[model samples]
Target: MDRLERVLKGKLEDSPGASCYWWMGNWRGRGDLADLVLKSRRVLEESGFREGMRLGILMPNCPMVLALSIACWSLGGAVAPMNARSGAEALLRTISILDLHGVAYVEDRPEIGEALSRAGMPSAPCGLEGPLRPFTGRGASELDDPDTAVVFSTSGTTGLPKAVPISHGNILNNVTSSIEHVEFLRPGEVMLNALPNFHTLGYSVSGILPLVGDIAQAILPSFVPADSALSAINAAKVTGIVAVPTMLSMLMGAVLRGGERPEGVSFIISGGDKLNVDMDRRCQELLGAPILEGYGLTECSPVVSINPSYDSRRLGTVGTMIRGYEHQIRDLEGNLLDDASEGVLWLKGPSITRGYFRDPVNTAARFKDGWFDTGDVVRIQDGYITVLDRATDIIIVGGFNVYPQEVEMALMEHPAVSQAVAVGESNSMTGQVVKAFVVLKEGQEASPRPDNRLRQGEAGAFQGAPKGGHPKGAAPVQHRQGEPQSA
Candidate 1:
C-alpha cells in the first residue's frame, strides 16, 4: 500500500482516541473521523461510485471536506475539488471535463443543482451523521496506483480552470517531506487553516498535513472576516497559521484596529504568491512570530520548498528544496544554467504531477524528458531559490531585461501607491518596454506627472527616462485616480 493509505489506516487503528480536529466549537477524535470517512465511503460505494470514477467536492474548509475527499479515495475513486467561487459556466465546464459522477456540497443551492442536472451529474449532501459500517480491508489497489488521486482545478492566466490530477504518491510525498523538512508544528499544537481546501496549498498543508501528522486543525469556512480567524487562533491556541500574503495583511489590519494577537503562535507560513516585504515585516511584528514564505504551484502537489523553522532562513528567498526533490535552471534555448543565473525553472520529483488532466498538447509542451518546466524565471544560489518573475512577463528594453515584479516592487515602495501591475508593451527601438498601472492609497493624491511624484529610487528600471516624463521607449497610462482602499 502507498504511504498515504497506510498512514491513514494506521492512525485510525492505533490512535483512534486522539483529538484530530477542532471545528464549530468542538473537538473530534481520530476514531470518530475515521468512522465518518468509512461511512462516507460506504455511501459512495452504495451509490455506484466505482473505482476510476471521480467525485466532485463543492464544499469549503471544513472537516467534511477532508472526510469526503479521503472517503472517495478510500473507496477506490478520485475526488475533484471544485472552487466555491466558481460560476455556473465554469462549474459546468469542469463537471463535463472531469466527467464527475457526483458532487458533494454543504448547501443545496438551486443554481448548482440545476447546473448538475443539466450536465447529468448527481449531488450528495455534505453530512457525517450516518450509520457506522464494519471496517473494510485496506484499499491497496487504488492506493497503489500513482495517478489521479485528486483532480485539482487550476485557473491559469487565460482560460477556464484546468484540471490537474495529482496522484496519491505525489501528495503523500509532498506532505510527509514538508513536515519533516520544515518542522513547523508539533503533534499537539493546533493549526489554523482558513485557506480554501480546494486549492493545493489549502488541501496539502491545511488539510492533509494536519491529519497525517496528528496535529489538531481548526478550519474556517473562508478567510474573510479576519476577526473570526483571530478568534479561532486565540480560542484554539493555534501554533501555526498557513495563509497567503493578502490574508496576513488583513489579519495585521485587524490587529491594528484593536484585535488581540494570537498568543503562542510558533510560526506563520506564507504561500500561493510572493509575500510582500512590507506586509511580511509588519505581520511578524504584529503576530509576534516569524513569517516564513514558501514557493509552490498547483502542479507541484503543491509545495516545492519552504523555510526551515529551526534554521536560519533567508528573508527573500524560498528555502532549499525538500527531501527527494531536484531543481535546475534552463535558458530560453533549453540549455541548463549554473546557479545564480536567471532562467526558466524546471523541477523534477516524485511529488510533481505527471501532466494536466486531458490536455496532451499542453502537457507535452510543459514536460521535457521527465522535467516539468515551471514557467517562472528564477535564480538558485547556495541551494536557495529566488523567484524573479514569469518567463512570459519579462520585458526587454534596449537589450536590457527587466522583470515586471521588480518594477511592481519598486512602485509599491512609494507611499502613495497601494497596488501595482507592470506589463511589457511593444517598442520598435527597445524591442519591449515596461508599462505600469498603479492604484493610489486612500486620501493620497497623485500629481499631474506621476513620474515626478515617485520617490527617489522608486523607479528602478524606468529611472533612465528620456522625455515625456515616462521611461524611454515606454508609454505610461493612468488607469485610476485616488481610490478607496480596503483594509
Candidate 2:
C-alpha cells in the first residue's frame, strides 16, 4: 500500500470514533471519514478514474474536498488541485498544460463549466451538501503507491505557473519530519485553517497534517472579511492557525477596526510570503500568540523550513531546518560556500520533489544531481537560514547589487509607512536603481526621503538617489493597489 493509504486505513482502524474534522459547524468522526473515502473512491473508480489518472479538483475549503483528495490518492490516482481564485483563462491554461482527465469542483461555477466545455472535458460533483453513496473497497494489501499523489500550482510571480507533482513519499516524509519538530499539537487542539487547499500550505500543512496527527481542523471558506475567520476560531475554540503574511495583516487590520480577537488561539503559523517583522510583533499582540514566520515553495512539497511553535525561535530566520532535510550555501557558480556566507540556497531531502511535472527544461535548470536550486539568496548561520531575497528581485546599481527586500525594510522603518514594496527602476547610467512604494498609516503624511539612520546607515546609501534633480527620462514612480507613490 502507498504511505497515504496506510495512514487512511490506520485512521479508520485506530480512531474510528474520534472526531477527525470539524467543518460547517459540525464534527465528523474517523469512521464517518473512512466510509466517505470508500464511497468517494468507488464514485471516482466507477467514473473511470483509476490508478495513474489525473483528476483536477476545483473546489473551496471544506470537509468533502479533503475526503475527495484522499479518495483519489487511495485509489492510486493523482489529484491536481486548482486554485478557485485564479482567473478562468489561467485555470484553463493549467488544465491544458496538465492534460487532466476529469475535474470535480464544489457547486457549479459557470466559468468552470464553460472552460471545461471549451476544453471538451467532463466533470463530477463533489461536495458535502448531499448524501454520500455507500460502497465497499479492498484491503490495504491491494493498493500500491502512485508516482505522484498531488499536484500544486506555482504562485507564478515571475512568469507562467508550472505543475508541481508531489509524490506520496515526498509529502509523507515531510509531514513526519514536521510533526517531530512541532510536537506540541495536543490532542483535541483545534486549528483554524483559512488557507486554500490548492496551495501547499493549505494542502500539506492544514489538510494532510491534521489527518496524520491528533488534531481537528475548522475550515474557512475564504480568508476575507477577517471577522468571519475570527468567528470560526471562536466557534471551534481553535488553538492554532495557518495563515499567510497578508492574511494575518488583514485579520489584524480587522482587529484594529474594532473586531474582537478570538480566544484560545495558541499560535499563528505564517508563510506564503515574507512576514514583516513589525507586523509580526503586532500580530502577536493582537492574537495573543507568537507569530512563527516560515519559508517554503510548491516544489519542496510546500515546506522546507519553519519555526517551531513551542521552542526558542529566532525572530528573523525561518527556524532550523526540519529533521531529515540537509541544506547548503552555494555561490552563483554552484561552488559550495561556508557557513554564514550569503549565497544561493540548495536543498536535498526526501521531502524535496523529484522535479517539476513534465517540464524538462525547467527540471534540468532547477535540479542538479540531487540538490534543488531554490533560486533564493540566503545567509546561513549555525543551523538557521535567513532568506535575503529572490535572485531575480535583485537590482544592479553601477557595480553594486541592491536587494529589494532591504529597500522595503528600510522604508518600513518609518512610523508613517504601513506597507512597502520595492522594485527596480531602470537607469541609463547605472543599469538599475531602487524605487519604493509605501502605504501610509492613518493620518500620516508622506516623507520624500527616509531617515538617514534607518536607510543610509543600515542598508548603505540608496544608489542613484535623486541628486540635484531626478534622473532625466526616468519613469514616474508607480504605486501598487492605489497606494500613494513616492521616490
Q: Model 1, stretches more than 4 Å misplaced?
A: 1-3, 128-147, 155-160, 392-487
In model 2, residue pairs whose N, Cα or C atoms come closer than 3 Å (at least 3 residues apart or on different chains), thus clashing, are none
Cα miss at 234, model 1 (Å)?
Answer: 0.9
> Which runs of model 2 end up more than 4 angstroms from their true locations?
128-145, 155-160, 393-487
TM-scores for all candidates?
0.77, 0.77
Write down the lDDT of every candidate, Cα atoms only. 0.71, 0.70
Report, for all candidates in order, the number of backbone clashes.
0, 0
lDDT per residue as tens, model 1, 95-188: 6777676777656344555556566667755543333222222222233233468888754333444678988888888988888888765687
Could you tell me how far off, in angstroms, the CA of residue 287 lies in candidate 1 after the best superposition?
1.4
